[model samples]
Target chain A: MERKSIAIDMDEVLADTIKALIEEVNARTDLGIKEALLDGNKIRHFMPEHEGVLDEVLREPGFFKNLEVIQDAQEVVEKLSEHYDIYIATAAMDVPTSFHEKYEWLRTHFPFLDSQQFVFCGRKNIVKADYLIDDNPRQLERFTGKSLMYTAAHNIHNEDFERVNNWKEVEKYFLGNEEI
Target chain B: MERKSIAIDMDEVLADTIKALIEEVNARTDLGIKEALLDGNKIRHFMPEHEGVLDEVLREPGFFKNLEVIQDAQEVVEKLSEHYDIYIATAAMDVPTSFHEKYEWLRTHFPFLDSQQFVFCGRKNIVKADYLIDDNPRQLERFTGKSLMYTAAHNIHNEDFERVNNWKEVEKYFLGNEEI
Candidate 1:
């Protein structure tokens, strides 16, 4: 059987990048902003005072280096790779050092993932694939293929992906079996 | 090996009871609530006119007669039952008709689930089991056992259940390397 292809979003999909960034920025010099106000996925809300925080936090030693993989992502991807051409199609900004660090971390943790398959694009809606695994609701609706929303641990905004809480369902949907 | 006992929550965990309730109430003759304002776990800030609508909705046929199951729950539960003693532990108000109807609906859909194991209680936090699968974060925190939060498709409040998501992780935590 011809292997199916799966494209996964980067931020909040594979890694808890947003949470890490929020923690790193807040842990450092306080931006003097209310944490509750900056609770959700509105990245630019904290960017004003915590300028350069996103870049610095993502590049911090053991930031991306020590990122915890999404629950069951490693297992699901490994199993899916057995039957699918897996690709990391992300709507990530072109922050070279920070983005490269994420890729390196993914390579280290998910060694089965091909480094070349990681496509760092500004908009994932443009990409065409057999299946797309993303956390963004807007992006999910745009895809014609089977899509699994990667709901990050702290993301309370993308309620649409609530059904796709774990990688097991994604595995079941894409791979057609839950045992893997 | 002694089989592990698994506790399943009823509301958003097993059936789409909340959604059905909203739809039922909205379709009523008097209450003219245009949209359902379902919040993170609790349905707060509903139209004042819909106060009694909540009660009336519970009496509707579709609300009690044909509640939908959460995606992939039946499959996961059936497979899990192969290695576990599955029990339905739900927190239900003593609405006689609604209660009986829900029980009947559950029995009808997931026939593999032993009706004898179903226990409807006032508070799920007080329930005891080896494993508890629930969507409510409060229930998860209260239950000391290995609990897996049954995440909804648009939960938006997913961060709370980051530690546990899929049944595989729940199985791994409870059953270890025993072949399932």
Candidate 2:
């Protein structure tokens, strides 16, 4: 029997990229930008003056490597792995340094996922999977499969797809009454 | 209209990895193993005394980066890109260092191909496409697509799939009676 495949985005879906960005912003400058102020996906929108700050932060060697794992991501994904082909597909081309860092980070955090299950590419449109869970609506918008919007500070306002605010919600949606 | 997608392997199919291995063996050891003596995909078969030489060579920093490109791979792939959704799917997880090197090498050599077209993956079975051109019989064996065996020194003995000896044969099979 063919197992259903799920392609989960790394940055916002599994990794807390927004929290890291906020921490970096607060640490580097006196902007004191909080998560509440981060309304959209583009960091530049909140701080128009700091046009290149996001790019600078992304270019840092450990920016992606040091990101905190999302709550329950490891457990939920492991559960899903048993019933489906779980793929952690991340758009890592923007920062060349993040390639190996992300790979190591996945291995460190989600040891259950083998190296073969990781798909590091630039776009999500090329991915062929039965389901995609991502924070970016643009990625979900282009995906031909069932797109589940994983809530993030930047994507809270976007009501374009089926939303799953947390990993518990993800578990409920897929497993139905199964305990995590 | 949806274009037919073709997933092409990188190492032995597009890049001449055997040449690089032979060069590395000659440069590092006194055995001076030639291409004629190398029997299989694994280098350990030829050098029984140096059991870990293959792993050592693969772990080297520039092993995948400095590989020579297979003759006419660039031109044939470019021609194929005109009609099909061409994807360069390489099993890069064996060597962690290969992730970025393969990405950079693609950018440098196949300038026409964009970052979105490259799939740095582990198992080719996870890939979804209408056709797959690869040298590894294991990868092609499981792929649920039209598998075209790209002739490589290691895979030349395998007669499981339809064979394409060189880029000329590939062009003949695809763009028959049509000039590139």
Candidate 3:
């Protein structure tokens, strides 16, 4: 049987991006904002100056390279890869400069996946897959397939799609009681 | 009426890639290969050393940044953008390093189009649009929408799909009698 393809988002879904951003903020300033303090909101909301600082960091060349992977992401995604076709669909166009970093990041973290599995674009609606795993509700808005919302602090209130809080839940949703 | 989206290819369709590649070969070695002599084939097919030299060029940082645009592509694509939702889709995954250069190239040549319209991916099958105007037949193979094969020296023998010989024909096909 042909394995069903799954399009996975990189930022918060696979990589703990907000946490990294928060860390960058803490390292730069005395904001000392913990991930827990974010409480399902972006840093810009709590940032004192705001002034596009976070956006500026995102536009930097290496911001996306060293992002820590979400908990259990590697093992679960490897398991999922065995059962399904996996495509890493990232909206990298929003920060065009991050392309090389993001590509290198994916190559380092998701080494099993090749360049063919990467899709760097702005709009998620055009991605063809049996399922789209994303955190942003707007990214899932126009998707024609099954939408699986990956739980993140910022997207906690979005109740429109099936939510998977962590990689364990993702494995359960896709693999369903199969031992990993 | 909402404009029907067209996913246009960047290589042979919008940019004269093979011509540039041939030029690169002539610059390096004594292979006096001209675009017409090859008569619808790739640079590697005629290259004497053929030992991944062209692939090396493709993988370089700035190769895609300076290639010449296909004649009339700017005017016709600009005209098409007004009538159709234009998306510049390039298979940049084949050369991951080329992402930044490709984005910069697009920005320089097609400034009217924004980041939202750029898709740098490997598989053309995943791109959803009303029509995919491309040069590679394999790219059109899995596309579910209408496929228009843009003429190129290499793809001349391809008999599949409606062929658009040049940007003029592309304008004629889409805009028809409406002046471009």
Q: Give the candidate number with the greatest TM-score.
A: 3
Per-candidate DockQ versus the true complex?
0.01, 0.62, 0.86
Q: What is the lDDT of candidate 1?
A: 0.64
- TM-score, ranked from best to worst: 3, 2, 1
Provide the DockQ value for model 1: 0.01
Per-candidate TM-score against the hidden true structure: 0.42, 0.93, 0.95
Error of 1 at A50 (Å): 3.0
- The list of candidate 1 runs beyond 4 A from truth reads A31-40, A43-48, A59-62, A141-144, A153-162, A176-180, B1-180
Candidate achieving higher TM-score, 1 or 3 = 3
lDDT of 2 by residue, B1-180 (tens): 988988999988899888888788778778877776555455656777776877789889888888889999899889999999898888888787888888889988899998888888777766778999998899999787899999876776788999998888898888893653
Poorly placed runs, candidate 2 (over 4 Å): A178-180, B37-41, B177-180
**Lowest summed-lDDT stretch of 10 residues in model 1 chain B?**
B32-41
TM-score of chain A of each: 0.75, 0.95, 0.93
- Tens digit per residue, CA lDDT, model 1, A71-111: 77888888888887777765534443344466567778788
Candidate order, DockQ descending: 3, 2, 1
Global lDDT of each model?
0.64, 0.85, 0.86
The chain B TM-scores of all candidates, as shown, are: 0.76, 0.92, 0.94
Badly placed stretches (over 4 Å) of model 3 are A178-180, B178-180
For candidate 3, the clash count comes to 1
Error of 2 at B29 (Å): 3.5
